[model samples]
Target chain A: MSSFFLFVLTTLTVLMLVYLYRVVRGPTAFDRVLGLNGISTKAIVLLVVIGTTFDRVDMFVDISTGYALLNLVGALAIAKFLEERGEERQ
Target chain B: MTFEFPLLVLLIMTAAGAIVVKDLISAVFILGSYSFALALVWALLGAVDVAFVEAVVGAGLATVFFLLTLFRMAEKDTQIRRPPVPWIAFVALPLLAILLLYGAGDLPAFGDPLSPASTHISPEYLENSVEQTRTPNTVTAVLMDYRALDTLVETIVIFTAGIACALILRRGT
Candidate 1:
């Protein structure tokens, strides 16, 4: 509620935008992956804040947890799959 | 004016960023972030039950699946290119969002006490569901029981997504 929190949130949005730009414009495969991972971690915090704002703490918490799991698993799977392919050709 | 604006702004920003990004991996991550932001917004709005579901499925499992597909997709060729023009997604998305927002105008106000959500069957479920179903949250009871058939179908859908992903990856291998 305080201006300080607002400032922090605003700063996050700005940072997120910067990252998005990289993901969109990056010329390589890995760079985009890195950018996306960064964005996802930031999102966890954002979700809780939204829940608090709306007084939907109970529902949002569960959703946040699920989202966290999805990001983690999805990242690892992609990483593993890519690694395996690279190894096979070599 | 307070928390909701911050939350909504975050969600839209992430959503826009996800679609506009060209790098598939980055786009996936943005999607995850978008999901997380949406979950947080859900929690803040007193939809803890919904938040819990979204957090687990959308943020957790969905991200994992996306990464899996991305990894499987990486081939001998390493170059990833933009689709010549991503400006289109940016322009078109806002228009879609506005149209959706207009549709949303018919919906009830956020957390409106007198809304159907607070009245109708919800109140009854809230009051007696704990004792009747041995569940602390009526929402869970409703999801698990009252809507048992639909939930079963949804579970099947999740399973199908996993299977389909595996099948697709297997083919490339």
Candidate 2:
């Protein structure tokens, strides 16, 4: 891997650590959920980057598609759960 | 090295955060993030199939299950107090980590062709998969042909889990 790409990956990872801080210390459930959603979206991009590094974009792209689909579903489910839980508390 | 090291650190941090978080809902969300990080690390290591499974199972299905269980618990129970410092865990876990790290130093370097994992049946599977199973992907061939029974059992296990979850949740409803 070139130094440029390595630098990019390092920067992105540091960005993810920032997101991790939000996840760990977010004051509200929604903030934590949004943090997780952001991280998963980044994961899809990271998968593509790793695919290019391995020179097997075709195979890894398929996996990333699946990952993205599932992440969307999981996020929606969590949002619905949170909405319902809020109503119950009221 | 650039790819795996940062990801491994993130993975461990998220896992520990998930455990330490006071709220079950926040912990579940962090756990999903942890799974996403773990999947990336697996992809970086070239284990695309395992990475795929981790993405779907860990980030997807497992998170849903955790949220469902969290909702089932009473709201009061969800607000758990901070656990006391685990003295035994602090001692045993570090000792285990050191021992594992010491052992890992003796293992072959990453992607070493002569490593036991790469040298044994894997090479033969890679060489013969296409011709023997008529499958283009060696991973597909190994899962479907070389270890069909194992795959079948895994499918059955997942099916049973779904059934069990349905049964339990149905009763509560």
Candidate 3:
């Protein structure tokens, strides 16, 4: 089970790298934001997987919960900022 | 341990991307990714509490604050011109990296049970934390009980900073 979790972790990290490439090379700011959001989602899952590896899911769950809430708030704040600035959706 | 290298590479890449990006918004987003990668690195190193703080402050609040600052700036100011590579950076960066690597070489291996910290007060804290503080989490007991005043002062500092920000933003608008 632990090895399986490690495998999953490797795959997620690879996917995260791909998203990071999009963030760096994307043509538009929106693409960068999308990539960041994708990375945050993956990070939350990564936290849980790490907790599983540590055999301390309960402890890490609390942190991941706080992380998810804050991630949402941050994304919403950015979206509102962009909308208010009237950035073109490209 | 297998995932650790890739995550560290991700951290380096995100940091470099943040620096190289010309758009301020892209830089801010890349910084957010950097924070997430750093938090993961902290977790991988068995520093769950530190990871939590990094996730909240670095990835969350810091990103929001950067965006707020960008929002207040003129749009034209957000697209920075690429500056010429500084000769000083070429000289200083390699020297700094070498110095840091030299320092790191003397540090104990990760999770070394016989390391100074592990051999010293850590064992005492681990053994007695639950009995004294009724907290299963030793890190929590240490932070909230053994070093309560330090934590309280940190909280107060953050609260004060929040109030100051509110005042400044209010005055601006």
Candidate 4:
């Protein structure tokens, strides 16, 4: 069971690396933001998967909850900033 | 341990990407990704509390603050200038890397049971922390009770730094 969790964790990490490639090579800032969001969403799951591996699901769940909230707030803030910038240009 | 290598690679890649990216917004986003990688590394190392702090402050708040500062700047200024490569960095970087590697050699291996930290004081704290502090988490008990003053001071330092940043970045009244 633990090994299965570890496998999932490794797979997620690999997927995150793929997203990171998008972040690095993406042509537009929006593409980079999308990649970042994907990475962050994966990280939240990674945290919970780590907790399960440690046999401390409750603790990690709390951290992941906070992480999710912050991730959403950060995405919203960036979106607002981009929107304002677009309005200024127009 | 097997997953650690890939996460560390991710960390290094994000850090390098952040530095090499020309667009300030892209760099900021890459920095946020760097923070996520670091937090994952901390979680892998079994430091969930540290990972939580890294995820919150490093990834969340710092990225937003960076974007806010970038938004305040002119579009032209947001494009980073390609500075000439510094000759000094060539000499200094290798020297610094060598010094750090030499210093690292003196430290105990990761998770060594007989390491100074694990051998001394840690056992007692691990045993009695819950009884003394009534906190289920030993790390929390140690930080909040055994070393309460230190944590308080650290909080004050962070608060002061936040104030300083706001003062420096404030616009005209």
lDDT for position B40 in model 1: 57
Looking at model 2, the pairs that clash are: none
Q: What digit string (tens of lDDT, one per residue) describes model 3 on residues B1-173?
A: 57788888898999999998888988988999999999889877767778888888898888888888988888889998986998999999999999999999999997899999999999999999999999878888998899999999999999999899889878988
- Candidate number of the best TM-score: 3
The local distance difference test score of each candidate is 0.68, 0.85, 0.88, 0.89
lDDT of 1 by residue, A21-49 (tens): 66666676556667767766666666655
lDDT of 2: 0.85
RMSD in Å for model 3: 2.0
Candidates 2 and 3 compared: the better one by DockQ is 2
Off by over 4 Å in 4: B163-173
Task: Name the lDDT value of residue B19 in candidate 2.
Answer: 89
lDDT of 1 by residue, B1-173 (tens): 46457567767877887766645666666676676667656665555667666666776667676666556555432235655667888899899999999999999987687998788887888888888889766667998877889999998998998798789767975
- Candidate 2 docks with a DockQ of 0.81
Tens-place lDDT digits, model 2, residues B1-173? 46677878898999999888887878888888888888888787767788888888899989988899988789888876975888899999999999999999999997789999999999999999999999877877888899999999999999999899899988997
True contacts kept of 1: 0.59
Docking verdict class for candidate 3? medium
RMSD of each: 4.9, 1.8, 2.0, 2.0
Off by over 4 Å in 2: B86-88
